[model samples]
Target: MTLQQWCFSYRGRLSRRDFWIWQGVWLVAMVMLFTLAGNNWLDTQMAAFCVVCLLWPASAVMVKRLHDRNKKGWWALLVILAWMLLAGNWTMFNGTWQWALGRFVPTLIFVMMLLDLGVFTGTAGENRFGSEARPVNYFGKPNYQ
Candidate 1:
């Protein structure tokens, strides 16, 4: 997808290929943000802004990823709630081990969930979430019967 389309496109389900492409883009953006900002107050602020900017696309990707697993996108909302709790500790209160634990533990769980979703192929044929993501094609063209 084009950059603008990637930014704006949130409807329908995303295939595993789409999710990986978005992830690669996100990783590149993050690396650039860190390399440009370095260890400075500006870096801190920019990091926060970057996170805000990425939140929607990230959420959309996660939702679609879950959809690929035949789960409702609402489950991603719970992931957000967990993230808020984690971020709150870092932002509102001084960084504490408790806060780190709060963030890291739940995040580990979430990562595991993502691994499960990505590693296992979805059900063949249409599901409640959407049509089965075109047959693992590299180009993402739907293989018609």
Candidate 2:
């Protein structure tokens, strides 16, 4: 598949390299966006629009990467939720409950999710989420079957 397809599709497996590359790209884009915000090149509305545009592609890539590990893409949703609660300090429970569980539990879940996605290797070949994606060449040709 093309780089665009791999980066955007939610129905395929992605190699670790491709996953990291897209993540790096996302990081750089975020930094650039923040820089734009700093310089007033992107106003609040523009920043919000840009963030919305990035959300799906980021989620798509995360889902594909989860597929690579032979897990359902829905796990990506859990990851996001866990992250939001953990890092964003969002809690529906009372402050006491938050005080008890918030400090350690959410952080643990968040780190485990990161290790699951960022450290684990993909299934050797394929199990369910279609066959492994063959690496494409510079010319956009598949390098292998």
Q: Judging by lDDT against the true structure, name the best candidate.
A: 2
Judging by TM-score against the true structure, name the best candidate: 2
Per-residue lDDT over 1-145 for candidate 2, one digit per residue giving the tens place of the 0 to 100 score: 6767765678887777777777788889889888998899889678778878988888887888888899998887775666566665537778887864656666777678778888898888867998975553335865564
List TM-scores for all candidates, in order.
Answer: 0.67, 0.80
Give the per-residue lDDT digits (tens) of candidate 1, residues 1-145.
3444444555446667677777788889888788777856356786879878898888877776777677877777777666666665455445676666577767876787667555666666788876766423445565566
Query: How well does candidate 2 match the true structure, expressed as C-alpha RMSD?
Result: 3.0
lDDT score of residue 69 within candidate 2: 92
Regions of candidate 1 where Cα sits further than 4 Å from its true position: 1-7, 39-47, 88-104, 134-145
